[model samples]
Target: MDLDHTGVSADELRRLLRELSGDLLSRRRFVRTYVEMWPTRLSRLVAAIDDDDLDETKVVLLSIRSSSVMLGVTGLAHLATQGLHALERHDLIECRHVRDLLAESGDRACERLLELEATESMLGR
Candidate 1:
């Protein structure tokens, strides 16, 4: 449950499970879906920034930030927020840096989530 290095909060994940009626199946499914979509989301985000599509970048960033917060992916949420701020300031350079960080963080988060899911399954949680 010490998932600090993963940038995910176990307590927050539990809170989300509770909010989802405490359904273990639902929790697993949600985690799976989030992990599965991360690559595409990251791609779109990078593409938007590369294209200099400010509106698309904002949309993608907000989407990432909101969903990350909901799923307790605190690191990703924080990075997305920073990306938003950079966008707001018209700092494309900073936004690019954040995008790189996001890629790394997103990969780590997905790996951790998958490990957590496997652990939960093995323990029948």
Candidate 2:
């Protein structure tokens, strides 16, 4: 499968579908859940950062990075990884910058995933 310009990897999504025994319904459900939780995740990440809670910030960044990697959200994953590195260096400024980037990229990624899902369903993929 070709990679999407939306920063989502169609190949990885297909792999996930294959892991679910090619069950489209399951894939759709998972995607929906992921999309729905995105805002909450972002909110939690912001809260953690604003509170200067390093541990919480680390947990949130790791969660975002791991989940994004699995979901083929490469841009968001990269930003999350950057946030983690910034956190490790105790660079709040860099961490804040990455957090902003994540907010933008993550939203775009989720929107693209939804669009992809709709297109796939319409095309009977």
Q: Cα RMSD to native, each candidate?
A: 3.6, 3.9
Report the C-alpha lDDT of model 1 over 11-94, residue by residue, as the tens digit: 667787779776878888888888888988899999999999999999999988898888778888888999999999999999
Residue pairs in collision within model 1:
none
What TM-score do all the candidates reach, one by one?
0.88, 0.88
| CA error at residue 63 for candidate 1, angstroms | 1.2
lDDT computed for candidate 2: 0.82
- Clashes (N, CA, C under 3 Å) per candidate: 0, 0
Backbone clashes in model 2, listed as residue pairs: none
Show model 2 residue runs off by greater than 4 Å: 1-6, 123-125
TM-score, predicted candidate 1 vs. hidden true structure = 0.88
Candidate 2 lDDT tens digits, 99-124: 87777677779999888877776765
Q: What does candidate 2 score on TM?
A: 0.88
* Candidate 1, superposed: residue stretches over 4 Å from native: 1-6, 120-125
